[model samples]
Target: MIYTEENIEAFNEQARLKFPENKKFFDRLKNKKIKKLDEAFHPVHEEVFDEVDCLKCGNCCKTTSPIFTDIDIDRIAKHLRIRPAQLVKEHLHLDSDHDYVLNVTPCTFLGSDNYCSIYDVRPKACREYPHTDRKNIAGILPLTLENTKVCPAVFEIVEQLKKAGLGNKGGIVE
Candidate 1:
């Protein structure tokens, strides 16, 4: 079944409700993705993708932190019309990677309509949400896996591959 942004959102919510029971499955997929990032490339990206509506599934925007560079900070702060320190105080924190990132869940910066509060000057990572995209596709599998849990399209694509006997076979699709 093709996953539209709407259904994907519904499923993500369902997954959360069932999170306790499905934790292992999600872990398995996450681990499998790490171990076989290379194999995941074709299977994940072969699916027809959809434009992201942050309002529908703000999981990525809200739950996880994205790596933020100095330029990202400056741009976002400029958009917000406050000092960089103020923006950092309001929306971000220093991660283990030593990068500034969103500090809260459901993203403090995500609007009720799913629009990023700092869209034009948002962090680089927000601009490149599903890294498993067309340009430089071959170089993004690892990054994509890291985001697969929060992205239903990637999750469903990989799920379909395993069910269709494609994961282990690693066969070419003419």
Candidate 2:
């Protein structure tokens, strides 16, 4: 589905309804063989994104903060023609985890149309938001589990994984 404002709410509701089953499948991973699935995950991620357009949803931008590395701070500051410290002072705060994060939601850089104001020099974490295509895919299942609520693409990817027989009653080893 090409998610939009009108239908995304319903779609998110469905994703939420299915969250527990998805969580259970991930919970079993502690003992299940995970390494082999990394090879399976990338192509699945690519395939889901071929149909899911993030610009239409942008729920990640609306809902969460990306960790801002020092490099992200400096690069975005330069792009905005401000000092890094000033940018940090104006827009960011150190979270409980001691990571720099945007002070506001619906991010300051997020345009009304869901484009990023500083797209060319956005934070590295922003660039890697949702992290579906990262290496060691199984190690990040916890992160992916959290993201399924916020990203339709991630939700779709996990559903695809299940359909591809990651952990059916027959089990993954088969």
Candidate 3:
């Protein structure tokens, strides 16, 4: 199903309910003898994104901040014709993790139409938001779990993984 703002609230609510089960599944996998969980996710990730378009729902940008690296700050500052320090002063703050994150949500560079004003120079983290299809998937399962509620594609990917019996015996469940 298409996930637009009108339906995303309900979708996220459902995701919230599933968090426990999802967490359990990942935790179990963490303790298991699984191999190539990340590789297993590749096709499912592609399939999910094929149907779920980010342009239709920029909830990630609206609800969460991406980690901006030093390079990201420099590039974005240059793009805006501002000094890096000034950009940091205006738009960023160090989070609890000591990473530079946007000071506000619904990101300042996000357009009304859900396009990024700094798409070309967006943060490395922004470019890799949701990070599902990346290699070494097992290492980032925790991060993936957090992203499920934020990105519809991530939510669907987890559901698909569960259905595939990810936590089942014999490597991956499926």
Candidate 4:
């Protein structure tokens, strides 16, 4: 898909509708401990991302907050020429998990054009949004399942994985 705002909104709505089924699929995959999960996911991740432009759909930055580690805070503060303490006081709040997150959605640093103002110094979590290309893909199935709602690329990746019979015991259950 083109991943325009309208198209992404529609895809997100469908992702919500399909969440239960996707959740079950993720659960099954998690239990199966599918070997070579990174091998399975990386190629699909590359393929889907080739077609999906995140700049066109900033739903993730628009809706979710990345956890800002101390290193992230320091780097972003340095980039902005501000004190880390000042940055925290002005823009961040501690979440239930005691991680520092943005005080507002759409992110304080996100531009109207869907580009990050602090892209160069953005948090580690922001850099790793969706988390599909990382090693130990099986360990993050739950996180990936949740990301399908926020990222069109992730939703498409999961759909492609399912069609490829990801968790099936006999290779590529066709």
Off by over 4 Å in 2: 169-174
Candidate 2 structure quality by residue, lDDT tens digits, 1-174? 767766889878988899999899787664575557666777888888888778888888988999999998999999999999999999999999999999999899999899999999999988887788898777778888989898888888888888777765575533
* Cand. 3 Cα-lDDT: 0.87
Best by lDDT: 4
lDDT of 3 by residue, 1-174 (tens): 669877889878988999898889878878884787877789999999889879888999999999989999999999999999999999999999999998999899999999999999999998987898898888887899899878889989888888877778643643
Ranking by lDDT: 4, 3, 2, 1
lDDT of 4 at 169: 63
Worst 10 residues of 2 by lDDT: 165-174
Clashing pairs in 1: 62-107
Off by over 4 Å in 4: 171-174
Instruction: For residue 110, give model 1's deviation from the true position in Å.
Output: 0.6
- Backbone clash count for every predicted candidate, in the order shown: 1, 0, 1, 0
TM per candidate:
0.66, 0.93, 0.95, 0.95
Candidate 3's clash total is 1
Question: Candidate 4's error at 104, in angstroms?
Answer: 0.7
Determine which window of 10 residues in candidate 4 has minimal summed lDDT.
Answer: 165-174
